[model samples]
Target: MFYWILKYLVVGPVLKAIFRPWIVGAKNVPKTGAAILASNHLSVMDSIFLPLMIERPMSFLAKSEYFTGKGPKGWATKWFMKGTGQIPIDRSGGSASEAALNTALQVIGRGDLLGIYPEGTRSPDGRLYKGRTGIARMALVAKVPVIPVVMVDTDTMLPIGSSRPRLVRVGMVLGEPLDFSRYEGFEDDRFVLRSVTDEIMVALQRMGGQAYVDDYASKFRKQAEESGAAPTSAFS
Candidate 1:
């Protein structure tokens, strides 16, 4: 299929040669079955590079905006995202978001790896922000392992609002799988969900070594924009 051809034959080879991505603890990921690869969102390329490095195809839940653009560029973008195994979904909160959650659960139910960014959005700065409980919700509901992944220097290689890659080596660290079976039957509990989310974030902080901020990345960006400050920096 297109995913394998692009991963093994086309784009993957070119990217590996250029970036020379160094992956540590690759063995931590299971060869098969359902699992959630929980990672911090650094740049847009996080979604691209993670799948290329892994042997199995990773289905990421992407915002619908990526699939709903205009003109030739939009067409290209949509296909590119599709080819990369991304599933487009409405990110808007409330009832509309249920569809995305259903899609994610379906992917996991099919025994496929589902990648998710707990922060919900890329960091305005390099700091690791508080995670969303949605990841925990999915993991607990699906009863799958949550593997924490860290993308080192990815933001530097391809920062936000930058059209070109910097051609620098990137590093990734895959932490051991986190098991939350003790919290089983408590997925609907908001307190338990936040606790699980924080535990995953702590693992990411340890592996990524980024400063931990208790606020969400989206909230931070909104605050910056409200203050009339530019919120486009790769790192603060």
Candidate 2:
């Protein structure tokens, strides 16, 4: 379908030829069944390059704004995101978080791979940020394994606010699948959720080699905005 055509025929080949992305531990991804690919979000291209390198088609819970933009560039962005197998979910918290969790569960319910950025948003700096507990909840509820993925140097290729990507090699590392079956029946426990989320973030930091930041990335970005500090790009 559109995903196949875009991944293999249209956009995939072009990206492969240009960026020449290298991957390690791709065999860690399960060949079948439901699993969550939790990654550290460094740049927007983290979504694109990870899915491109993996064999199985993965779906990401992308923000709804990507699907509702106006004008030609917006149209192209919307088309590309859809064509690449991204599902739009409102990131606004409260009931919206529940809806997104349900949508993510539905993806795994179909025995498909669901990509999630546990950090919730792209890192304002190159350091790994605290992960949101939603991913932990989803994994516990879905009763599936969670694999830690790390996208290398993606921010350098396409930093925030950059309109075009640089021609550079990027890489991905997939860690072994993490089993949280011990806490299977405790999905509703907030303490357990935080513990699970912290465990996953530790794995990512270990694999990705990024300095760990205990605070949330979104909070850091918001604080910077409120203090009149200009957002700093990864390259900057």
Name the best candidate (by TM-score): 2
Give lDDT: candidate 1, residue 130: 97
**Residue 65 shift from truth in candidate 2, angstroms:** 0.5
Which candidate's lDDT is highest? 2
lDDT of 2 at 96: 97
Candidate 1 lDDT tens digits, 1-236: 99888889988999998889888888989998999999998887888889988888889998888888789878887888899999998878987667777899999999999999999988978899999999999999999999999998888887755667898898889999999999999999999999999999999999989999998899887787677664564222
Clashing pairs in 1: none
The TM-score of candidate 1 is 0.95
- True lDDT of residue 151, candidate 1: 90
**Model 1 alpha-carbon drift over 4 Å, by segment:** 226-228, 231-236
Give the TM-scores of the predictions, in the order they appear: 0.95, 0.96
